[model samples]
Target chain A: MAVIDIRIDLKKGVADPEGNNTKKTLESLGFKGVTDVKAVKVFEISLDMPAGEAKKCGEDMCVKLLANPVIHNFSVTVR
Target chain B: MKPEEIRVCVLRIEGTNCEDEMADAFRMAGAQAEKVHLKQLTGETFPEMKRNLEDYDILALPGGFAAGDYVRAGAIFAARIKSALGRDVKKFVEDGKPVLGVCNGFQVLVELGLLPALDGTMSPVPTAALYTNDSGRFECRPTVVRNDNGGRCIFTSSVERGKLMMIPSAHAEGRLMSRDLDFIRKLEENDQVVFRYVRDDGGKAEYPWNPNGSESDIAGICNPAGNVMGMMPHPERVVTRFTHPDWTRNCPGGEGDGLQIFRSVVDRLG
Candidate 1:
């Protein structure tokens, strides 16, 4: 009944150390498949197995609680 | 001589990271300023908090991560400012009061529909100000920007047509976009388009320097009344001489480029 989506920004001035470190580690492992990997903000969400309110609630969470309104951004959908 | 000591208001919110620098810059520019948390303002809705609007000559929204850039950049701030804070901003503009939005603040303006159209007329909902940077990422750099709107904006009066100034921008979604082409052309003809990012050669509007792929390589703009201004760059962050990205080579230019905006508003109070 519910599907939610959230996006997180890489912190301002954050050199994206995770991405650089990943590339280095991959190269040392002799993995050629990894070229670039940027760390992004993630919303680890658990939703109702099925329902409309999940989508609705996700939006509420962003506007009031999860979202800081000063920096981070988000969005929502139901499936 | 000090321009009647204009009183200005600088707002600091949880994600709003620029008020402190903006306040210091305003002080350096010789204006009386009060930086307050919107939480401390005692209001159920945004309009109620506006009690302070009449008390200050200019209202400034500084750049910083607000609401942690949730729901798209500046969306939470937009929502807060729109239904709650928007009515008050509307009143402020009607009275010819001055307002400035920088970086995240610029996003908030667009989200709230207050920026591109404060021409003192029209707006069931003001349809301008702030947009995605089209770059799909954040850009932080120093570059030359040309002022397109002359003395119309209180903060830009000192700017000469074709004058070049420097400011740094940091944002992921800073591109300017509008669906209406006619609207864009009219804004250009009216000289409402204020700031455009230019090449280092300073001859044309080019990429990287412009950062965001805005409609006309636009970096910033003001309303028709010229009282409300918005831009993606951070003027406050570079107010200090040492804040320049290239400080080792140059002494930060005179009080800093951002300070001029504060002074221009105080001058209006005089």
Candidate 2:
């Protein structure tokens, strides 16, 4: 079985309200030099297939439902 | 068909909390309306509960977090619909039947690729999305929306062109965004934009007046054919005058601004 992990985040130009608020909280805690923050949704999929095939399926999942291409970007990693 | 002959289906699933009000709105407009579970349409429910999409003259997707809005708002519900009754939905639209979605329902329509179906009955993938609000918090407030569809949108046919209507909006993720460069031009050219957020006097809106900062101050849109529409405001909530946020103060009297939407679509059937 192959374990695939997909991480989806708002595209570069899209605003991240939750992530930005988190950054604001961190700065209020006296953390310095926080330029930007990004919040992402991760999905861990267990595929009973070869690593290559698992990766392909993960990409398809992202395109179909896991991530919205209009506002998000996604990456798949197989382990 | 006559208005009384129209069968309106207010579709719902787990977490779809607004079906009752939506169905009531249609019934108030003098149609035969019922709330049907998604399972019923997908054949997962009892045989007696099964419903065919072709049986309904109007389909209404009401507001609420369908499937809990996980994996992106409306993603799960849209996926289930695509897999279960995609063909039926496509045919319904192809036949020019009216479909309305409000608030979270609007999110579902975008996820389902039904609104602004610029090139066809439904896009293979979502061409747009309702992103989280710029305020980073859920907004529940009274808003003004103007009919700009110029009589193209069937749902807004009764509403006068450029007339402002008071509609209450409540949502966390209501900012509509798209990657299409010609989105505004296409919407204008195709007469797909049905409603736009505006000030009480019909002036351009900004910030809270514009609510979630949706692109072009858009609050609602229709498919190119104008049979399908999705809006962020809850018109059902205002079918009566008492439901208005400032009904007592404004005292508009009798029916609410939103009743026209329901009456307009029902009138189409007649």
Candidate 3:
């Protein structure tokens, strides 16, 4: 069995309202150097398959459901 | 077909709270509307409750945070619908049956690749998205949307061009966005743009008027064939004059501005 990890983030230039709000909060807490904050989502999945096949499956999952290609960018890795 | 004979399926799932009002709106429009659960349509419910998507003449997706709006607004529900009933929905649109989506439901249609289907009836991937409001707050207020489709949309055929309708909107994410640089141009060229947020005086909408800061103040759009439409406002909330914000002040009409939308499609089916 292999485990796959998928990470998704908004594409470049897409507005990240939540992330921006979090950054503002951080700045107010004395983290004044914060230039940008991008919120990301990670999903860890356990698959009963070979590592190579699991990686392929993770990519398929991102395209099909985990990530929206319209405004999101995703990467898959086998763990 | 007669108005009473039109079978309108007001689809619902967990966290979808607007189905009742949506079904009621259709009923008021003189059509037979049912609130059908997603499981029923997918045949996962009891035999007595099982439903076939093709049995309905019109499909209406009401507002609310379906599947808790996880991953993104309407992403989870759209994925489930795409996996289970994608072919059926595509066929439904191809048959020229009407599909209506409001607020979160509008987000679902965009995620399901049904709206802004510029190149085809349904895009393989969503060409546009209903993103978070520029204000970053859940905006619940009255909004005016001007009809802009030039009579190409079946849902607004009864509404005259440039007519402004007061429709209440309640949602956090309603801004329509696209990565395609020519998205607005393409929509205009294809006559798919249906509604634009406008001010009370029918002037260009700013912040609270435009509500979500959508590009070109776009409030709703339809598919190339004009059979499918998705909007970010809650038209069902204003089917009667009593539901309007200023009805107590001076109720000018027996029905509300939003009733015409439901009546338009019902009239088309008739």
Residue B115 miss distance in model 2 (angstroms): 1.5
Runs of candidate 3 with Cα error greater than 4 angstroms are none
lDDT of 1 by residue, B177-233 (tens): 654557678677656687888876677766688887776778888777777888888
Locate the minimum summed-lDDT window of 10 residues in model 3 chain B: B246-255
Q: Sort by TM-score, best first: what order? A: 2, 3, 1
Interface root mean square deviation of every model, in Å?
Answer: 9.2, 0.6, 1.1
Provide the TM-score of chain B versus the true chain B for each model in turn: 0.88, 0.98, 0.99
Output the better candidate (1/3) by DockQ: 3
CAPRI quality of model 2:
high
Off by over 4 Å in 2: none
> Which residue pairs overlap in candidate 2's backbone?
none
Best-performing candidate as measured by DockQ = 2
Q: Against the hidden true structure, what lDDT does model 3 obtain?
A: 0.92
Instruction: For each candidate, give its TM-score against the true structure.
Output: 0.73, 0.98, 0.97
Best-matching candidate per TM-score = 2
